[model samples]
Target: MKLTLRLGKRLNRSWQVDAMLMLLLGVFGAFMAIPLIYVINNAFKPLDELFIFPPKLFVRNPTFENFGDLLQVMKGSWVPFSRYIFNTFFITAAGTAGHILLASAAAYPLAKHKFRGHKVLFTIIVLSLMFSPHVTAIPNYMIMSSIGWIDSYKALIIPAFAFPLGLYLMKQFMEQIPDALLEAAKIDGASEYRIFWQIVMPLVKPAWLTLLILMMQMLWGADGGSFIYSEQLKTMHFAMGQIIQGGIARAGAGAAVAVVVMIVPIVTFLLSQSSVIQTMASSGMKD
Candidate 1:
């Protein structure tokens, strides 16, 4: 039997090379973990240690005072800290769910079915990815203002609903689904809706789970931008920024805030990392 050249049998040609590569990977992994370790250590460091001459990688004397300070700062805010937490959760959930559904729905026909102007439509989506979000900020603000969505959660959630990258990823992943599977379902008396919801969507689980990580990172970091004016509507990220900007006194508290803000996105990635790895492995992408 012949083996496919690209399916990774190449890695087994030399055991010594494999051992060397594993060592190399372990070294790189440790390097990558440095920042995460530093953040965790810094958050627990005392205020005095934070200003040491050359700084330290690890905390010599750890303390929970920073977390306590964070709590006090949260309590000092006029808006309840829970409100900011709620707003962040709501926006992240709503935006992520909507983008997944909308992108998956739009991707279905584009991936499996041919239609008029399909190529043109997909071209536009691809083109949109070339521009950074900052380039669209002014236009997005104008649209939000005109729609009276400013100062509301709609300003935050609605703008992220039509994420082009989500659709791009979904469509690419969906293209790998064999059309024969859908045809088999059709022959079994499944409607188009049933085939999509049950067949296509489930097969693309990795794709959306990966998309969830991406969307969570974006929405989790949202800071109300220029649209939100209402104090109650601000996200936890926006509130954290306020707490982080209190100069030298807030240094420890700022480190604590960084840890807090990173929690959700890191957790989301950890939960979905296997799916993401599966998706990437099957993607057949090359450098």
Candidate 2:
């Protein structure tokens, strides 16, 4: 009877813990979602509704005027609106693609190979993550200027290829691969590069998806920082800033830009979320 009571108590405590976790998660989700919901609603709100005293969380009457205004605003641009779109798309695509390939390549060797100073190198990388990118921005700018890469795409894309966090995550994921599988490939006359491309790459589909999502988030809303100079080289984010600069009369258009700026990352995350979760589950540090 005593043992039965103890078991029952244990089960009760587990249930209590589970309930607490669920409640906390629900509250947190609601808090995070409220702003996103408001943003979506605001995008459809006409200018009058936007400025209504006491504001609103939802639109009673919806209209496409904001989006239309966005196009109209862009139509008067000195530079073609399409040029800004192309620049943003190109920068994001090039930066993300380069980061993934280079980060994955660097990760493979760090995870599987034993090389001199390897541990030290990885230690430095982890340490580097503790500092903010702002700390390195000046030096990075100096290096870019020294190389005559200022006002060019290479300045933006090349430095991103060595982002420490991506390399760290990719390395951790790669470590989950069995050494035996790699050895088997080697015995079968597979070169290191061939094994990496054919055998190893396919197995980490979820990690790649996770990496792609991270890279997308970093690149999608970029404004070309101090690296880009030419008017034609400016990104959609710069155009968004110009729209927002229109002030009160263009508030709805600004909201439309916000919606567009937010949608790409949100859609990308939704598409890759399942894979990211699976990858993260398998990537937990193991003893």
Best by lDDT: 1
As a whole number from 0 to 100, the lDDT of residue 162 in candidate 2 is 82
Predictions in order: lDDT? 0.92, 0.89
lDDT of each residue in 6-74, candidate 1, tens digit only: 665562346666688899999999999999999999999999999997989999999999999999999
Query: Lowest lDDT 10-mer window, candidate 1?
Result: 3-12
RMSD to the native, candidate 1? 3.1
Model 1 lDDT vs. the true structure? 0.92
Q: Residue 251 of candidate 1: its Cα lDDT?
A: 95
Clashing pairs in 1: none
Best by TM-score: 1
Candidate 1, superposed: residue stretches over 4 Å from native: 1-11, 285-287
Candidate 1 lDDT score at position 112: 86
TM-score of 1: 0.94
Q: How accurate is candidate 2 locally (lDDT)?
A: 0.89
